[model samples]
Target chain A: MMKVVKRTYMGLIFLFLYAPIAVLIAFSFNSSKSRSQWGGFTFDWYLDMIGDRQIREALTFTIVIALLSTLISTLAGTVSAIGIHYMGRGVRTAVLNVNNLPVLNPDIITGVALMTLFISSGLPLGAVAMLIAHVVFSTPYVILSVLPKLRQMNRYTAEAAMDLGATPAMALRKVILPEISPGIISGALMAFTMSIDDFVISFFTAGTDATNLSILIYSMAKRGVKPSINALSTVMFVTVVILLFIINRKSEKGEELML
Target chain B: MRMLAWPYVAWMGLFVIIPLVLVLLYSFTSGDIHDMTTWRFTLDNFARFNEPIYIKVMADSFLLAVASTLICLVLGYPVAMIIARADLRYRNLLLMFFLVPIWMNFLLRTYAWMSLLSPNGLINRLLLSVGLPKLEIMPGQGAVLLGMVYNFLPFMVLPIYSVLSKIDRHLLEAASDLGANRFLTFWKVIFPLSIPGVISGITMVFMPAVSTFVISALLGGGKTPLIGDLIEQQFMSDRNWHFGSSLSIILMAVILLSMAVMSRIDANQPVEGRRAA
Candidate 1:
């Protein structure tokens, strides 16, 4: 009886969570444009979504900005994590507190602050501004992700490599880099996710000419129902599920090997 | 390595520090952002915010955020407990269900709710089919609150689940061994230990709920305007940077004040638990 109750409770919560998504996926294939009624299945929405130029541009911008920000932040964050790891306690603490500002503050504050900065500084609020904003918010996350691995690392590994006649630069390249590669990869993944998933910050910074997928969605959502958005959601949801499944499988295998 | 950090430090200073300073500067001065000569130091922006309508928005934002956080706690706690106590093989799978929705774009997720709750949308259709009255919740505080809970439920559950799962089994055993019933064991042993997670979860849910314009904008149907909407308007439409900056400052103060209170509560918990034990 207790087990049954627990299962039912879990089922209800999952239902609440998935009901909207299920409705969305179902509506994407509906031949009817009305949201409330389904009039047989069709693939027209998917085709329409693909044919839409604005959505295509938004998708392109989303992926490109995500890629660029992830690359820049990962490189800068990994280096800074190394630097921060070697800093004196006082400076490290202060820098870390500063780093947490973007992470801790509300997204709107960060968005508005950056928007204020760009406007005041005479910087054009477009793709470049959006890229800069993405990097600013994402780099701290990478630093946070990489810093843990740096702490876990054996401090003397690089020094030992140096003692064996390796130059400081060579030791860093061969020893420290490889040791923290996992952190770097995960940090890069995080930065990419953050950049891609961002809406509030992007909304403020993207300006008139640059609209990412999220900005496009927000505007469309506000204007009322769009069947194309439902289609887009289905595609993105499926893609995310597949990616997460692969990641989960790989991580499970890693655990098995460790065991 | 220290030298390697300079570039990032410069970036942060330029992007993070300077922007915030600019906001602070704007909050205190009325000006054209492009031209410095027109800038005049004044408290008029904040004084404008002293109006009753602005205060009501702040109060409503606070109330709605608190309500959402409370709802999340009530609904999420059991979900967390169940997941934590689940068999090891299923734990990750169950947790993944919670995370997948979050990984979906937040706006899309809220938009999903909009379709479900709209007057002519799925829920009303279902209700009509069932010979029931239509449930009209969209474009209102109810919808906004629902959106907040739906979106933030995972934030509440994940933290509590992590804390609950890490709790020492031996402690529960000892509680049961000491003439305590299952309920008492949970109350005395498990609940107290999970307070930190609860505090963090509350902070996580409340902060975003209070500051989000998207959920309220999309789900609230322009009827329910939170402080976020006001801030967005000030910046995006009103083009009143001074008033916006002042609103942002107040929002920051509210968040910081709440966090300080939460941390104080968190700090005091262990001692109280020890005494009770």
Candidate 2:
């Protein structure tokens, strides 16, 4: 009886979580334009998604921003984490507390803060400002992920390398970097996901010419979302599933190495 | 390594520190948009909350946020416990299921609910087909509360599951050996141990729920306006930067106060990994 109850409860929650997503995917194949009724099954919306110019442009911006932000923030955050790991206790705490603000504060506040900064600094609110905002929010995640790995490392590995003939830079490159590579990779992946998934900050910072998929979706939602959005979301869902599958396999291999 | 850190220090100073300071500056001054010459430092923007309507909005946001957090805790605790105690074969897969929805664009997911809850949407159609009355819950407070629970459920579940799965089984056995029943064991042993996760989850769910404009706008219709909506309106619609910044500061203060409360509850345990809000 207890087992039955647990299974039933799980099923109900699962239904609650996935029903809307299922409706969305079903509507993507829907021949009708109306979201409420399914006329029939068709692939026209998927094809239309490709042909839609605004969507194509938004998709381009989304991908480009996610990639650039991931790359830049990962590099910067990894370096900062290493530096932070070596700092004196007080300075490290203060810096980390500051770093945690963007992560801890509500996204809306962060968005407004960045918006204020750009307007006051005279930076035009376009691709540059949007990218800056993405980097600002994303780098902290990278730092958060990377710092844990840094703490777990064998502190003597880099020191041992330096004790030999290697210079400090060379020791860092040859020893510490490899040890913390997992954290860097995970941080980069998270940064990419955040950059892609972000809406609020992007909504505030993006200018007329520079819009990502989230911003595009928000505008469409207000005016009523189109069937093409269903198609877009389906594609995004599939991509994430495949990406997670690949990452899962790689992490399993990492576990095997540890064992 | 220290040299490598310099760039991040510079980046944080420019992007993180200065931007927040700018919000503070904007919050304290008036005539921000109108007159460049007659800038006056004022607290009227903060004082605006004294109005009954604004107070109601803040109160409503708080009540709804609290309700959602409580609902999440109730629903999430059992699910987390089940997953934690489930067979090893299914554990990661189940955890992935909870997390995957979070990976989807948050706006898209909320939009999905918007359509699903509309008068003639899929859910209503299903109800009608089954000879049941259609729910008129959309575009109201109930719908808003449901949206909050749905979106933030995983936030509650993940943290509790992390803590639950890590708990030493011997403690539960020892409780049983001491003649305590299952319910007693749970209350005395498992529940107390899970407080850190509970605290973290509550803050995680509460912070976002209180500040969310998108969920409220889409699900609650225009009837319910959260602090987030007020802030957005100030910037986007009203073009009142001073008022918006003041509201933002107030929102920050509330969240910080809650964080302080959470830290006081579990002074020793650091919220890390997936629990790192």
Candidate 3:
């Protein structure tokens, strides 16, 4: 009896969670423009979404920003994580706490704070400002991800390499880099995901110069329902599911390598 | 190796520290941020926020956030308990389902609720078809609260579930041996043990819900405004950076104060059940 009740309750919660998503996916294929009424199924909205110039621009911006931010943050974060790992405890804790500021603060505050910085510094709000903001927020996550892997590592291995014939640079490249590569990969993935999905921060910093998919969607959603948005949501949702599944499978085999 | 951290430390100071300092600088001064000579230190911005209308925005933001956090706790605790008690083989899969919605764009998830709750939308259409009166929740506090609960439910669930699943079965067995019934065992043993998770869950949900402008803008239909909206207006529309910075400071203070209080409560909990064997 208890098991039955539990199952039913879980089922209802799942239903509530997925109902909106189901409605979105189903309506993406609806031939009629109306969001409420169901019409005959069609792939026209997807095709329309594909053909839309504004959306195409937004998609391009989103991908470029995500890729760039992930690449830069991953490099900077990994290097800094190594540095912090070797630091004296007192300075390390202070820097780590500072690093947590962006992570801990609300997005709105971060957005406005960065906006004020950019404006005060005389940097115009646009793609560059947005890119900078992304890097600022994303690098801390990379540091967090990489720091743990660094801790788990045998610290003496690199010193052993250095004490032998290996140069310091070579020891870093050949020994330390490979050991923390898993953390780097996962951190890159996280940075990419966050950059792509960010709306509130991007909304503030993107100005009128650049529009990511998220910013575009917000604008469209504000104006009213658009079938193209429904189609876009369906595509993005499927992509996320597939990507997460692949990541999950890889991490399961590797063990504690992904966040 | 520590030398390599300097660049990033410098970068953080420029981007993270300096910006926050500028917010503080702007909040206490009312003039162009660009021109130092134009700056005049004053508390007028915060003083302006002392008005009743603005206070109501803060109060409403708090009330709504609290309400949503409470709802999420009530709904999510049972789900967490069920999942924690499930077979190990099925546990990850169930947790994955709960988290999938969260990976979707936050805006898109909120947008999904917008479509569902709108007048001619799914819920009302279903209600009309069933010969029931239309449920007019959209463009109101109800819709905004629903959006908050929906988007943040996973945060509440994940933490509690982690703590619950890690709880030692031996503790429950010991309780039962002591002549405690299941209900009594849960109240005395399980609930107290889960306080840390519950506290973190509350912080996670409450912080986002209180500070979000998106849900209030979309679902509240501009009829309701939270502290986030007021701050957004100052920065984005009104171009009143002074007032915006003040509001952001208050929001940060509220979050920090609550977090401090939560940690105090967490620290005060009995230490026995907190540790898992």
Candidate 4:
């Protein structure tokens, strides 16, 4: 009886949280202009999304930028995490602070700072700048995600490997990598999601020729909200929600949670 | 090792550190919009920002952020507590609902909110159909506050849950055995001990609330401009880098000052000094 009541309460809380989003998605296919009528389900909006040139370009650009940024940041972050492990207490703390500064800083401030850096670096404000800025901001997340797990892994394992005459590369590739594989995978995903979902930072860095999905959506909303945006958002939301569930399920099977 | 470290240090200094220093310097300088790059040292921008508009906006941002933070606290604390107390079998499900939203595209989230809150959208339509007065939600500060709270709630919850879940249940049982009721024991024992989680939640929510731009822009509808919108306009449309830099300097000052205050509060919190209080 107690468990049933608590479960019902949990259901209600989730309903409150998700009802608005669920309703919006349902209303997208409504035949009327107003959101009142639930006329019928139709594929018109989803069909339109595939044909729309702006969304196609924006979605492609956003994914490409996210992928590149995640790849680079994972490399830098893993290295930084490794280096941080070897440092003394004060130095390690300072480096960790510098790494985590991006998390505490405001999006708008980072955006402006990146813009300044690009202009000063004489790099044109476009895809390259966005990629660089995304990596710079996201590397800290990758570091935080992976480092504690690295610390948790038995240090003796690595020392034993070194004593067995393995090179740093060999030990990292063979022994350390397998132990912290979970962290690396999750860190990569975190960086990927963060880069892909970001609008503010990408907006500041991408001057032209590189508009991301968020920018496209924002511009369309500025003009006016449309049923098509609702359609696109519904699809995106479902994809992410399902993906998150799958990831969590795998971790529950003793794979390890996203670090 | 030093050589390897040199590259990263140089990279961070040139891009992150130097520009912030430049922002401070530029805030003290005066120049025309036409030639903002070439600065003449003066305190004019800071002086001009002493106008009521900038001052009021900063205060409004604080009020809005604080209100949302408080709501997140009330709403999130119960949820975090329940999750912490839940069986391991059910805890992950609760956590997923709280966290999966953070993974979805934020633009999509904002756009979804825009549709819900628009004039002809579900909220107003529902009101009209039910014979209730249509609430004007789009133009006001309330909508932005709601949007910020919704988007940032997980940030608040995660930190609190992280602390709460690790707490030993025996502590609660000991308090209960002493003849304390659930609510009273929570007040006397649980709440006091969870100060660390509370402070962590505060910083997690407060920092993001003060700086978020998309929700403010999407929900604010280009009117009732916050410092975020103003800074964006200065950098892009206004093309006045010096003034923009000055605004950034002031904004950074506000954030750093708040963090300082939060740290002090965290230090003097009851859990830190008196163990059994």
Top candidate by TM-score: 1
TM-score of chain A in every predicted structure: 0.98, 0.95, 0.95, 0.88
Docking class of 2: medium
TM-score of chain B of each: 0.96, 0.92, 0.97, 0.93
Q: What's the best-to-worst order under lDDT?
A: 1, 3, 2, 4
Clashes of 3: 0
TM-score of each: 0.98, 0.95, 0.97, 0.92
| DockQ for candidate 4 | 0.47
Model 3, span A62-177: residue lDDT tens: 99999999999999999999999999999999999999999999999999999989887899999999999999999999999999999999989998999998998999999999
Candidate 1 lDDT, tens digit per residue, B162-271?
Answer: 88998878888888888899899988788998998899899999999999999999988878689999999999999989889999999999999999999999888878
What are the clashing pairs of model 4? none
Candidate with more favorable, higher DockQ: 2 or 3: 3
The TM-score obtained by chain A of candidate 1 when compared with the true chain A: 0.98
Assess each prediction's global lDDT (C-alpha) against the native.
0.92, 0.89, 0.92, 0.78
> Which pairs of residues have clashing backbones in candidate 1?
none
lDDT of 4 by residue, A1-259 (tens): 8678767766766765686678767876766655555667787887787888888888889889888989988887777677777677787788777776677788888888778767765799999888888988888888888888888999888889989999877888888888887888889988988888888988999897789998888887777756777778888888978877787778787633433
- Inter-residue clash pairs, candidate 2: none
Model 3 C-alpha lDDT per residue in residues B1-277, reported as the tens digit of each score: 8999999999999999999999998899998756868999999999987899998899999999999999999999999999999986677778888899887888888898898989999899999999999989889999999999999999899899989998989989999999999999999889998888899999999999999999999999988899999999999999989989999999999999999999999888876755551
Q: Which regions in candidate 1 have their CA more than 4 angstroms from the true location?
A: A256-259, B271-277
